[model samples]
Target: MHREIGPLRALANGVFCLGLLGLAGFGAVQVAGKNWQVQDTYHLSAAFDSISGLEPGGRVFVQGVDAGVVEAIVPPSTPGDPVRLTLRIDARLRPLIRTDAEARIVTQGVVGARVVEIRPGSAEAEILPDGGVIASEKPLELADLMQKASAALERLDTVAGSAEEGLAEVNAIASAIRGGEGTLGRLLTDDEPVNRLVQLTDRGEQTLADIQDNLDALKNTWPISRYFTRRGYDDRDLALYRPNASRKSMTISESDLFDPGRAVLTKAGREQLNSVAEWTKEHLTKKTEVVIASFTDNSLDDLMAERLTQQQAEAIREYLVDNHGIDSAGWFRSRTVAAVGFGRHRPRMISAEPQGTSPDRRVEIILFTPQAAS
Candidate 1:
């Protein structure tokens, strides 16, 4: 009976140890995250001058959509160096991010934690590649505001002191006049001084009129005219910056923008793009968008045809981005530039000739001008 009891006691200890191991494993899993599955995402990085309150695990928003999270905050090497932030963004929403997209540190509330907000660059801009390093802008913090306010107060104090001195000087002059101490006192008693003061007032008014004339001349010039006369027309200029104000569409043969069926840009293509970029940059506002669509011959396999067209469109977009930068308002009169490949699906301009000709292989650039097309 003693030997049987000894064997049963050993088995009971083994069972108790297994129960403790199971509890430890469960605790580890719970600490990891609520769901054990890993999310499908891509990585992006940005450098900021200072991210004072940004923390790891902060939320990232894209145009108000919760699109990603901050993964880590890397310390700068030197005191004045920029801090690098790692971001884990959704893979599917990659296209929304363009080169012009900007990252900023934003606050939850008056005293809440800080989060990063990503404003999408443009609807027509090229998608940022995975693991790309983008630009970042630092938001104004409470500390910075306080420092500015303090400086302003110091200036106010200086101005107040100067004003007090000015008042004292004016009082001294009045007292001198009352006592008839100087030339000003003599002028107060003479008609010649009054005539001189009238002459000085007339000169000041003429000087102001000349300055106004100079500003009007500047407004009529090429560079200054754009800003001063943003209103180009009469009250009917309601369509100046509207989305559908003046829509213009044109189709360029693949030969004009690219080699036959190939995506490599030729000399003429570059020239065409330079002109287009300049025109688009000048006319496009923040809200405007530009779309570049590519086409291919229908004779090829459907998949290959679609893929080729897309590559062509992407090639054009790449050129535009590299030369023009991301099309957005923040980046110097930029507009959102996007690209799509139709693959012979929508051939608005049918080739009058044979099916083998490469006219079907073309690119269509649709421009949405903010102002009326002249």
Candidate 2:
């Protein structure tokens, strides 16, 4: 009985030892599978405009040395096209990676793993510490570069075609203009037009010469004599040409005609003139009151106040003659002459003493026959 009891205890002990060995084996396997060096790895993140092809578990290298692997590739949080990728690398090589160090995706041999490679920048660059990020030079994937190059080539082709078309159109337009095919054609090709222009120029010259001759003949006459030949009178009718030879004399009653100092006529002088005109019309013969309200003074303030010019005043005079009721008589003479002469004589001296009186500023005239002498 004692021998049988000892055998049973030995069997139970063997079973318990086997069980412990099995548990130890499982723990070892878990440790081996963990594979990550916790204290050694440094973390960094890089952003790309577009990460078309990249995957986790891709190898990370520093100047060809295996440093780390890609941890994650995060898509852009926003709507625009951007991507962010995270990497974990060993901390021991952090001093080798400068702040200016760049990261890029490169392939191993022919069938090697895709890797995140670092090209250590200048010696002047600061060494990148553990978990510090180095800038990523964009990954050079052949397919993406090819696609962009293809698009650029297409745009270049389009621009070249447009430039060719523009050149052709410009050439055609220039050819047409040179050939004189349109309205410009007649201007360039017609010879009769040139002849007609020459004839017109010659006629203009002849007419101008005739006018100059007539002017020269008129100037030869005296100051008070007529400068134009009578319309109905001819050379044979020279004796019949009663050339207004008699200088009709008259006395001026109004004192404003000769002011104290100034030569220019005044506004009050103009009003007094009109008054004399009214009196003459009420009691005199048929004579036109041609009152040209001429403003010839050189005063900028007066021009501004009136806001009308000499040209405008002349236009008003023309309008009155053409549209209004001012009559035209054959001969012009002084109102003083009319007052003293025989053609329905009437006279009145218009007073000059009035408010807002501009002195010696206007003219009043009356028409009369020389035969009607006082």
Candidate that would win on lDDT: 1
Per-model TM-score versus the true fold: 0.39, 0.32
340, model 2: CA deviation in Å? 99
What 10-residue stretch in candidate 2 is worst by lDDT?
338-347
- Model 1 error, position 23 (Å): 21
Name the regions of candidate 2 deviating beyond 4 angstroms. 1-35, 144-374
Q: Summarize candidate 2's per-residue lDDT along 1-374 as a digit string, tens digits.
A: 45455877899999999999999988877663343344467688777776554688777787667777778888888888667778887778777778898887765653456777888777788887666766877666756645655655565555556555555655665676688766666756887655655655565565556555544444433321221221111231131122232222112322443242233334555555445444444433343223222222333345341333222223333333344323433222222121111111111332222134432222223222233445
Error of 2 at 185 (Å): 51
Q: Model 1: how far is 95 from its true place, Å?
A: 2.5
Q: What are the clash counts of all predictions, listed in order?
A: 5, 5
Task: Report how far residue 164 has shifted in candidate 2, in Å.
Answer: 28
How much is 353 displaced in model 2, in angstroms?
99
Error of 1 at 303 (Å): 71
